[model samples]
Target: MQTTSTYKILVVDDDPDIVEMLHYNLTREGYHVAQAGNGKTAIEEAQAFKPDIILLDVMMPVLDGIAACRQLRDISEFRHTHIIFLTARSEEFSEVAAFEAGADDFLTKPIKPRALLSRLAAFKRRDAQQDEISNVIEIAGLRIDRTSFAVYKGDSKITLPKKEFELLSFLAATPNKVFSREELLHNIWGSDVYVIARTVDVHIRKVREKIGEENIRTIKGVGYKFNTD
Candidate 1:
């Protein structure tokens, strides 16, 4: 139901030029925009701006993007917020670290404005689709609540990053039905977003860590299933 005009975006980068470019482009697209010069400031700005989407830079003074992302994810209010990392580092480890820190997406700069815009549009479509799905699923002792974007294992609360939570929720929704990694990638990340199949495995592992490994069963070479038995 939220329109482009109402959707807030926070662009955080140490480089003034990058921040300026992103601000101009996002504002031109009718998105309400805010900017921060570093990760530390980004967190403070996020508290006040309350952006639906955040474009964060990796290398920064005061605090790094990965640390900032981890800190942000710990905050209950921002748990479901979209965080995309924009970094010059294209190394595989950097990408893995970014995801581990709870980033929703990773982009290497020099940023292509058009591609970034397309990704943002894809996120908007995904959000709309998410709104149409069932909001909660309870299985065994686990409860996945999409309404608050929170999960509960019996009376104990478990906090999972956005992608991990989605992966768990999607599988748990279908009980014992097994879903391939490709199917999970398409369903959770969407077909428009380019991410390797391994990303699913990473998220699956993280989800298991929070909710317990026994809840999700890996079917040899086939894929993963939520164990209802």
Candidate 2:
């Protein structure tokens, strides 16, 4: 339901050239774009602009992107916002740190505008689909309330992390339809998040523990499926 004019994006980077580049491309693509010079400024702008998506740089003065992302995640208003960290750093630790800080995705420097636009388009599609399916989902003795962001199994309400809840809800939305790990990652985290395949397995195990393993079936070499039968 995000029209081009209504979709707001905040581009945060210390480099003016990069910021200008993103602003130009995003505007040309019919999105509302704003720019910030550093992480601190990005945080301030995010508060005022309430952008739907944020493209934040990893390194900056006043405050670093990871810390800024963490701060934003702590706030209820920005908790579900799409935040993608932009970094020149290629180290695995840096990527891990970004995710731990609550970034939805990460992007390497020297960005290709066309590719970025494609990813954004894909995200919009998924976001719209999720919106349509946000009503309470009940399947296999599980009750998922998207509005309350809560899940229940039988009579007991389960406490689940944000990602786990999303994963479970998505699987239960279409019971018995096997979804590959890669597909889950793409749909849940967006196409740009660079998480390893093991990440999905870890989350799956955690979800299974909370919801009971019998509900979610592993397809060995293939993927996973929710059993409604």
Candidate 3:
């Protein structure tokens, strides 16, 4: 429902060229843009700017993007914010590390301006669609509230990163029905986001750690399902 001009974007990278390029491109698209030269500054700017999207570089001085992202994910105010990792490293381990640190999307630089914009547009479309879905789901003594992006297990509240929470909620909504990793990837992250299948396993493991292993079941080769019985 909101226009591009209403969206706030934070571009965090150590390179001045990268920051300037991203700022120019994003601003040209009518998005409100801010820049940070390192991870520490990025965090400070994020607190004040409250950007809806962050393009964070993996390698930076002071704090690194992975650490910065983990810290940001801990803040309740940024629970739903989209954090995309940008790195020149295309190694599998780097990709895995980014996802584990709470990154929603990973892009290897030599950044493609058009692809980046498309990813942001996809996120906007997904958000609009999510707005129409039911806000809360209660199952097996756990409460998943989409409106507040909160999850409660009985009287205690559990903190889960964005992707973990979405994976949990999606499975819980259709209790006892099995869903493959590919299916879940398409539904939760959307077809526009590029992430490996192992990313699903990482999120599932994290969710189970917080909410208990009994709630979600692995159906051997079939994928995963929420246990209702």
Candidate 4:
């Protein structure tokens, strides 16, 4: 069970005012907040700040939100970080694209503070409930502990970025379940993001690098499934 102090958040946006506004509002709601002006900073903040959740922007210089989200997805530690993309693009295709990029939700720009707060509260509820389910899973020498938010390979602790850890843990939790990329985005990444199924592949590759090539079974045409047996 994580305490309230553990619920820190990172807000990624190039717009200074947006960052300031969100930082203030979220702080007022009692959430610890950090700010990143670009995708590069976002990743650095993600790694260093270790925020529990992230509010990432869709457009920025150096690195866009989508690209940044993909980068975060590669890291094991931030794998499960709740990410909501705040953007001005609201086209149907764009919304779908966000989901493909591995976002938990999307909020068009000129955000309604009330709606943002409500959605965050909902995510918080789900996060707390999920925290109770337990995360201890072992496949041979590899062990993952969800409750403690840790992973290990033969007693040696291994660190992962946010998205990478979540992907491994999710697949591990359901060994043998043939999960399509779209399914992963919807279930693991959340449907609101607008990326593509390929993002799942990116995450999988990084995870395999951490664990082993044989640890994850990619069913080529179908999708990905954990090789528990």
Stronger candidate by lDDT (1 vs 3): 3
The C-alpha local distance difference test score for the whole of candidate 1 amounts to: 0.88
**What TM-score quantifies how close candidate 2 is to the native fold?**
0.77
**By TM-score: ranked, best first:** 3, 1, 2, 4
The best candidate by lDDT is 3
| Candidates ranked, most accurate by lDDT first | 3, 1, 2, 4
Ten residues in a row with the worst lDDT in model 1?
89-98
**In candidate 1, which residue pairs get closer than 3 Å at backbone N, Cα or C atoms, i.e. clash?**
none
Residue by residue across 95-183, what tens digits does model 3's lDDT show? Answer: 67888888999777899999999999999998787777767998999999976668999999998877788889899989999999999
Query: Model 4, 137-201: lDDT tens per residue?
Result: 98757888877667899868877655667788888888888888888877765543445676788
Error of 1 at 31 (Å): 0.4
lDDT of 2 at 43: 85
lDDT of 2 by residue, 145-183 (tens): 986668888889887656677888889888999999999
Segments in model 1 whose C-alpha atoms lie over 4 Å from true places: 89-93
Measure candidate 2: CA RMSD: 3.6
Runs in model 3 deviating more than 4 A are: 89-93
How many clashes does each candidate structure show, in the order listed? Answer: 0, 0, 0, 24
| Reference-based lDDT, each prediction | 0.88, 0.82, 0.90, 0.79
Q: What are the per-residue Cα lDDT tens digits for candidate 1 across 27-132?
A: 9999999999988999999999999999998888999899999999988889889999988855344566778788888777999999999999989998887777
**lDDT of candidate 4 vs native?**
0.79
